[model samples]
Target: MLSRSRALPAAVLMAALLGLSGCGDDTDEPTTTASDSAGATDSPTASTSPSETAAPSSARTDFCAQIPKPAIRTALYGAAIYDEAWAPGKDADVRGGVHAEGAEFGCAWTAKDGTTVTAWLFAAPVSADEGATLVKKAGAGCEHKKMRAPGADAAVTVQCISDDDTVTRTQALYGDAWLSCSLQTPGILTRLDRAADWCDAVREAALV
Candidate 1:
């Protein structure tokens, strides 16, 4: 029963164990400074600002409906699937940060082997700067990299490997909404590559 509060710190520790260094950048890709990352962590709940509370009336609220079952199966490498809603009041409690307040929608799929893939969608009135800030915050300490996603103003992929498991998180910002998907697998599994694909699938369905 991994909770959201424990996910980011584990990823940070994994980055240290793997000897990974600071975040990288490319001319054509979005970049963030160590200062930006530090600032994000200093204020984890910044996404809950008053402006965000005034999200557009049409902001999406049914994120689970946007995900395709086949995508989940493929992301898990054909593992048996048990679909579960990860809302605030559900059995699977997702506490901490913006998630603690309540996401527009959240879903989790558990593989037969106990691996889990979770996706959360939060719709808010996000500016470009705010979106970038959120991505950096979510990706702190992991090997964060830029990604291209349909309908996304900004996108990033983060990967971390620990002795017991590997965690991959993909995040994208589409207009006034944000979508994030995290995959946790046993050992140093190469299934990390599939994180982007799963995220793309959801972005295509939910945003485009």
Candidate 2:
């Protein structure tokens, strides 16, 4: 049986992907510590305040490093410059649900021309019957098709046009892992082939 708790609805996933945007550099604010205070000296009696405690470490960060830069360039096509838009431990400007769901890893790359590609993997234990059902629901109301890909137990791709942007998305299941990739390009029509490549690359890099 499919775990509804682990399976995200198609709308939630689409909203997460469409809402992605470039994250700007974060500026750190200077802070005054116990030793930095006026007339303060380095004494054993000085104690650190609760607010000065270090933040908890991120759950993960190495997810983005698995995918090579060359694969990203191929996914984005004409984009000359591209940067990592989101990764674990980064700001919540990207897919917060990915972290909320304890995703194995979620990554997004944005180009200077507003083109973006995102890939994520979720560990959902479901049978083949349930996987097919999930895939069908995800590809509803779009140009949906199924295909075979290396390392994937089952795979499907969907292409949809929203307003002035073309969105191509692919989802694949490998045992208990659910992998997905989306490519969104403004004013450009993208095909399922590119989306499939992006999905396959992610599966190869992550499932290994």
Which runs in model 1 stand beyond 4 Å of their true positions? 1-44, 47-59, 79-81, 88-101
Q: Which window of 10 residues has the lowest lDDT sum in candidate 1?
A: 27-36
* Candidate 1 to truth, TM: 0.65
Compute each candidate's TM-score over C-alphas: 0.65, 0.59
Q: Number of the top candidate by lDDT?
A: 1
Q: Give residue 119's lDDT in candidate 2 (0 to 100).
A: 63
Clashing pairs in 2: none
Give the per-residue lDDT of model 2 (tens digit) for 1-208.
Answer: 1001212232333333332222110110001010000001000111211121222121122344677768888987755243432222222322223222222235566566656676665432444564565565554456665644666666777665555555566666676455666666665464567767776676666664
What is the Å distance of residue 172 in model 1 from its true position? 1.4
lDDT of 1 by residue, 1-208 (tens): 2222211231332232232243222110001111111111211243334264454332355556777778888887775445544432222222222222332345566676545566665534555676676665565566665555666787767765555556566666777666666666666556545767877766665653
Q: What is the lDDT of residue 42 in candidate 2?
A: 9
List of clashing residue pairs for candidate 1: none
